[model samples]
Target chain A: MNESSLPFFARGMDPGPSFVDVLRRLAPHGVAGSGAPDHGSALIDTVHGTTVVAIRFASGVIMAGDRRATSGMSIASRRIEKVFAADDFSGIGIAGAAGPAVELVKLFQVQLEHYEKIEGEGLSLDGKANQLGGMVRANLPAAMQGLVVVPLFAGYDERRGIGRVFSYDVTGGKYEEADFQTNGSGGVHARNWIKATWRDDMTRDEAIDLALRSLFAAADEDAATGGPDLVRRIFPTVAVIDTDGFTSVSDDEIATRAEALLGGREEGAGL
Target chain B: MTMPFYVSPEQVMKDRADYARKGIARGRSLVAISATDGIVIVAENPSRTLYKISEIYDRIAFAGVGKYNEFEMLRIAGVRQADVKGYSFAREDVNARALANAYAQTLGQIFTHEMKPYEVEILVAQLGETPDDDELFHILYDGTVMDEEGFTVLGGLSEQVHESLGATYKPPIDRATAVRLGAAALTPADQAPLNAGALEVAYLDRARARRAFQRLKGPELDAVLAG
Candidate 1:
């Protein structure tokens, strides 16, 4: 709060390049997750986001998430974006409690940008994953109260010239996936779908189609997940992270693909 | 009992100003010019790792001349202040004027209270939607700030650089011309013009989306210099 003095930390108390640490130091209560729970049986049916998937291909990684949030078997939001670019090189797809999950994504974005500005370079892919792990671990108290948030991180590691994917548990346990990973109420279904079709040499277009199909399969089985809505003209959000950088696939392209895929399914069912 | 000689307030202030000026005069010069694309900053720095110009916020940039360690410390502090403010409030609320005032207050306090004043002069530039909206603030070691127009220069040889830059001080020029003008102004009259390898260049490109600050180095720097 003191604007005159420089925000210099003592050698022992320095936060270094961690922006989350700076926030924690400034406002201890704000970054401690939502609030204290009453520890009662009556659970809060907070809005929950569902079904995000990431797949690695030859050139880079493609991430996709449904635009649906659920609250006690009802649709809370039909157009909620769950996947976001953490920085230029990495993409993050979040699931679980919508409020805390979105907040965590915002914080993660600022953390990466802040560290890059202060340190004059971005963190390594592994370093960024570890930073997100620490943040998820810090949210343990809220996660215990049924407000869990698990995010899947994927990036094009320029150093190794390969795309990598990482997934996290509620307790902040991080695990690197070899090819693809998924999370949310329909994670298992989507993972099964991707596991069957995912190949090591998948092209960008193939990976994108596979991701959309997996989300479609998940939505068919899970009430929380929403499928592509043709009436509303709403399609799943998709993004690609490559050596060039992170880019969102346009809605027009995704809509076309969704229609084509749906037409094939409709014809097969008619038989 | 040892009795200290009482010095006049004016004399003490004058001596501190002179000392600070001498220290600043020993460093290489830096120039910043407002252009059509963005604001270009060029410094006669050979070291690639140690930056003389840096980003402070989404649309703001900071450049300093004088003691490297002192300016580097100030650069880091400015970044912290800007980042913290942006995080606490909305990103649009963070501006160059507030940051410049903070730097002034700190420098003024040190100039009067500390035994020795910091030997650094800094520039804070903010990119606007239009060329006329661009803001550049030049802050001296004694905490005096000047609202510069179009372009500003800092360092021991600022007077010479200013004169050289003024001859071709046209607003809304292209980025390459702005860089060339800045590099020309920073170079001494008797010496050959500086090349990309010996200069550090950066700009707050208005064409960018959020964070506008970008450094020009290696092949990119060479291409710009050639342009």
Candidate 2:
């Protein structure tokens, strides 16, 4: 559909109809309907939480998330992507139902970028966080039946001229992180690891290395957390946001960094 | 009961049009174009926070002139629609024409059903990966939808500005030429020429992403206008 909507004239159409409305319009009882589906039902899908960590640096912020998805006790996906660019200036990571969680983040990303495009500016960080909260809250009924979703959001606000990070609960409670934050089953381990290694005004390199270490520690302990897979050449996703904009480090670059992080740790332990 | 005062429908319509026009004429104007570098929009706005242009979809952009709050509401509404559409359907399905029609529908509704017509005019821009794919749609306060070929001028004195732009709008102008054209198009024949200091610029750069809307101000704008 070339120039499908020509949105300047598309003002009368209410922000694309709501998903629930779409379901109601297309088929009243279609899949993704209102009720919480039964757990362990054939429709029940496994969820995986990739390790994601955000660290505040002297100049801006560094964010990283692993690329693994586990279903129940099985490695459901080894290369499931979790990190996404929410908009030009921000990033988001997902944990929980791999399917719906990814879906929510995708919608959230589109919503933020969409707002920026339509409104000529993005929602404030607080506004963005609230927007995500509202989306998660909308999924409350689904969450009751093992469809929980949690997300981490971070961005470089041009107005504030600084980097900020936010975390979410299954019920959409948004909490701003002061320095660094992590999410998923391995979150606690990752948070503590970062606490031990983090400092105010750290350089970008130090921030990235510390973020990598925190994720590794989390992966070493949490079943849901995935560390660097050297044999397969799979590594975590990392992004940096400065005054310029949001840019993710290449997978190859991240693999190199992860390899060095592991090597240094092994050497320090004399292993 | 006293008979309704003899007021012709034409007179009443003319009065409403005058009021809408007056409100819109007081605001700064903006110009937009589809160039080889992508879609460029230039506005004579001084506020860094208050923007006259924005992105509404992966490839669609929104530019409004007149009351900021009124246009901003429309902008938010467009965002909601585009985001929802992209979620329910595919990104490629969201286009400029459908959105332009929707805006027309809403503006028509407001013009007829609402207490007051929206005192604003808007432009929707889209950049294609290829030259033939680009689009520009200008929607008026009365829900008038016009497909702008290559370039269009918006806001107050648009007629005069369009006359100035003339047929000389060089097709597939580079970004630099597009910026010069837009800035020139907004300049009045009697007023002093506009420079970077008096203009706010942005572009739908057709970058390697779903959303390509970006605002260019400050030194980046300074460098562009200086040339």
The top-ranked prediction according to DockQ is 1
Tens digits of per-residue lDDT for model 1 on A1-271?
7756657677788787888777777655557474647475328689999999999999999999999999987899999999999999999999999888888988898889888888988999999999999889988888887788899999999899988999999889999999999999998999999999889999999999999999999998998998989899999999999999899999999999888888888653511
The residue-by-residue lDDT of candidate 1 on B1-227, one tens digit each, is 99999999999999999999999999999999999999999999999888999988899999999998888878877887787777777799899998899898888988999999999999999999977889999999999999898999999999999999999887769888999899889889999989988899999998998999999888888887778
lDDT for model 2 comes to 0.77
Off by over 4 Å in 1: A2-6, A32-42, A267-271
Model 1 docking grade? medium
* Model 2's interface RMSD: 6.1
Residue A238 CA displacement from its true place in model 1, Å: 0.4
Name the runs in model 2 displaced over 4 angstroms.
Answer: A1-45, A114-141, A155-179, A188-202, A221-223, A263-271, B1-30, B44-50, B65-73, B109-120
* Deviation in Å, model 2, residue A16 alpha carbon: 15
lDDT (tens digit, per residue) of candidate 2 on A170-267: 78788998988888888789899888768887988888878877877888888788877878888888899888788888877777888888887655
DockQ of 2: 0.25
Q: What are the TM-scores, per candidate, against the unseen true structure? A: 0.97, 0.78
